[model samples]
Target chain A: MVDEHADPTVGELSEGAILRSILDRLGASNALVGPGDDAAVIAAADGRVVATVDTLVHGPDFRLAWTSAYDLGYKAAAVNLADVAAMGATPTALLVALAMPDSTRLSFVTGIADGLRAACRELAPGCRVEGGDLTVSDTLTVAVTALGALAGRTPVLRSGARPGDVVAVAGELGRAARGLRVLFERFTDAAHLPVPVDESVLAPAERDDLAAQLRPAPPVALGPVACDEGATAMMDVSDGLLLDASRMAAASGVCIALETAALGDDPRSALTGGEDHALLATFPHDRPLPAGFRRIGRVRAQGPDPVLVDGARYEGRAGWDPYRDWDARTG
Target chain B: MVDEHADPTVGELSEGAILRSILDRLGASNALVGPGDDAAVIAAADGRVVATVDTLVHGPDFRLAWTSAYDLGYKAAAVNLADVAAMGATPTALLVALAMPDSTRLSFVTGIADGLRAACRELAPGCRVEGGDLTVSDTLTVAVTALGALAGRTPVLRSGARPGDVVAVAGELGRAARGLRVLFERFTDAAHLPVPVDESVLAPAERDDLAAQLRPAPPVALGPVACDEGATAMMDVSDGLLLDASRMAAASGVCIALETAALGDDPRSALTGGEDHALLATFPHDRPLPAGFRRIGRVRAQGPDPVLVDGARYEGRAGWDPYRDWDARTG
Candidate 1:
């Protein structure tokens, strides 16, 4: 039962009251026109803006039992920021659309707002929530749209990779999936009451894995650097490396060859793991590799298989396909 | 009860397959980079972009039984378009984030996509769905983010109204709310099986009201016209004229005095009905009202009441507050 002295539920508060709480946490606006207007006016200095949207829905994306409000907000912002960065742009602003059950606590809402600000400050500095919409729903959902400025740099597309390009990646790979495994192994017990995760007992490495799962910090700063370094093709590694690489290969009408030896201890996990938000990019073999990126593979002419591991076709699970995997569950 | 051949559920298909079906219906993209990229690159002429987001959740916003997928999509896009237009900008692109239950039919998904495209074609030409994300959820949600181009014009703000300014409005003021009433009176019944509305027997005016509720076509084009005509302050009338006008009044530190005689047949409904998305604007007293707008009231120095009707303070409900009104229900 809710304590009478405790903070009231969002159902008991006005939308304006909740909005004021969030705005207070978001700090100041850097756009031409910020919140409180019909719409926000943002400066697109180069006359062009890069935009992308991503949504995190309850159950399918995360379980409240395993995630905190702050982590949820952080993950939501980080995921969308990764998308904008994948386009070789620096995020200028974020528009968040939050829908939750009215029973959600006012403190929980503020926690999320604080998390949104914290993510922007830590991951994509200078990029903050510019405007958003809040509504009540049966299921909790966070939909974020990120806008970025290319600053006159030509966008790096997945279809731009050519033969003889060196394949590389920036940011961690497989760690998030490992974190997911830890959650499934240690935290997904039916016996435990629903509560925020306690990672104190886990080993240091396992704690790191959990952090990767809950709050991913992708290499956002390296996106523009990769573009400036003449990267030919790039994309966010959301679904496994094997699956996403094949997409880039298919888009470019080329083939990507991976070196399992380079994949830190668990090659299989690195190849098939998902949700790392790593930047997968292809650069010219002649130029020096960018500072944050590590060479892991190479680009070749079109082949029967879009991706090959150490010369042979890598088989088994290609990666996470939301529809297919989700179907497997409910079926 | 399930038809073997009626359409496969979204759970039975891959995300890519569902995406392909929707993409087939969404025509083409006019942006620099469109769907298929991590992010879309849209041209924001004159170095400024207008951005906004709005969400329609299943229960609070629309019911599948009462609203067709097409109408839901159209209304979703239209509402966001009005927000952008209220800033005196021409919408250039939309990014839609849709989350639905796994049991949702492919046909329904495609219908919503068709509706989204139809709204763009009819309401704001040259604007299209450039990118979006689709996911699974227990509750259906549609979140749309619209981007617009200012074209070197200064945006009309709600805080710019002066005491001598004349208040004017473009488009229907209370039609959508009337349609909502019709829905509650006839549609929200315990016996109704959720079905697309059949308004075959309604009178023509009632039909128009229903259309306004289901698929609102707000005066989007008039926003730029008002801007060019030197509207001192402006906003969209989503939450009724009284509430929205008071918002404009409070932001400008003025009092809005509305005349009932100017509000057509049902002045009460016109004053308090919501969801019309009408453009409420103020212009200098010396300038002639724009062609599409009708004079509604005048602005005055700040008074005890932010809004005055016929020189007296409004006594009844000021307007719809999602929080307060919603609490009255669940309580």
Candidate 2:
């Protein structure tokens, strides 16, 4: 059993001490090099590796009141894993760096770890929490870096889309935005019993959409399968389908014409909402999509600024812009 | 040329706008999947890749007054690359995430990019900045993730150290600690013009040390050489030697004994001072030392912890502990 000392907040322990204790508990077998070194090393069996990083600050990305520590950990891991999956890679390991107030609870820290472990089990089975650094700060912030493997297949790139390629999407969209909206409304209605939205009123579509936002199930396996099946261009719809599609078009020197009518009801949500974590790709027009995907749009030979819906420009708010509407609404 | 507008701080720009502007300027050819997508994809020629990440926070890690925006960028890249080097990999790509106050200068942002480019040129040539995110916060923080290639060699890990392995180190020591000392001293001595120590001494060492702390010179090429020469256990020295060595011992399930005399003129600096960005490793005692390395210790079959100076326990401070001391002093 480990020795028990007076439990102090993160502020009470020095950075080195905190890291050392955590490393000791994590054990050294899994780590090639644990914390306290310049860096930690992990076994990346296949030579190639996929890497992604994301940072979440207090107030902006998450609220301690709204989400549990476990949720924060799970979300952080999900975001990074989504990046690796977007590259058609299988996540293998993770490194976390956290900064929080000294007064924060140890249970909170453990909850974060539990969340990370839970996400790793579900999304990135091969990945492990190899190491991390903990330091005391005024606010709580978490930064996670995830490493993945390409498994010898060529990584699907966004610039591979050619004119006339069929654009398809895998996974649900618009759920997370709806979830945020619901949560916000709840907070605003704190003066009286919060008017709970009817669960049935949230259509199956809406439920799926909310699920997509809260815990985005990144299409980790589809990337390599798409590459193997001859996908020309591929990307994950993170900012919004329209915005990401435009980026692919700009990169490939082609135009992407997304068809809103093809979006199977709730096209507005598909076009403007973000945080779906769906895999979007362009393939040869003649080929059928692999399982678990649906046709959404097509690559065009000629268009201006990557149009949507009958080659018309999408001028309305089509995705999230954190500095603008999201911030205004949240604040 | 792009359209000009009033330069706004990162907080003023939406996440999408910042990403779009950077992606547009990065050019089409180099970008596989530009920002706006769930993840940016880059083509990896070799089947192998290397990855590393580091996070830097304001006040605890660096003060804006002493370190510039450029310095933060350089430092962030340097530390992550050092990790890649420790893994016996050659850095090829980088992803960055920046969090800063709304009032941060555009010039400072550009300066940070310039610093990143400068460090990349020095350590990993031909590497491109692939992707990142920008957000507003009360303090400035930078997180950098770097990817590298192994060139067909197995990565060197720290768990391979064995009982009879010779311990060796490559790179300078104590420079960063001394630099910290100089920084604090300069602040203290600002009132007394032309005081005790030579101003020239104060500036040169201070500059060198600050550079060491800010823009570390990581030995990227050395890890592969050590791996090729049969390094049993390997790691980069980020913390003080004693602490790091202790970690190595704990990881390898073996004790390490240092030869105080062999550590060259400043043994204390080698033992307790850190941020030297040096590579430390253990090899079979019979093997000849490689170029640019000095044998400093040996792995022992039995010992209570990492020992120094001929079986004598090091009762002095082990290494840098953030919570214990903020003022410059030997850990």
* TM-scores for candidates 1 onward, in order: 0.97, 0.84
Model 1 agreement with the true structure over A1-331: per-residue lDDT tens digits: 7574577788888888999989999999989999999999999999999999999998878888898899999999999899889889999999999999888898888889988899999989989999999998889999999999999999889999999999999998999999988887787556533345678879999999889989999989889999999999999999989999999999999999999988889888899999989999999999999999999999999999999999999869989987777642521
User: lDDT of each model, Cα atoms only?
Assistant: 0.91, 0.71
Best by TM-score: 1
Error of 1 at B331 (Å): 13
lDDT (Cα, 0-100) at B201 in candidate 1: 62
Fnat across every predicted model, in order: 0.86, 0.28
Interface RMSD, every prediction, one decimal place: 0.8, 3.3
**Considering only chain A, what is the TM-score of each predicted structure?**
0.96, 0.85
Q: CA lDDT of B69 in candidate 2?
A: 66
Q: Give the TM-score (vs. native) of candidate 2.
A: 0.84
TM-score, second chain, candidate 2: 0.85
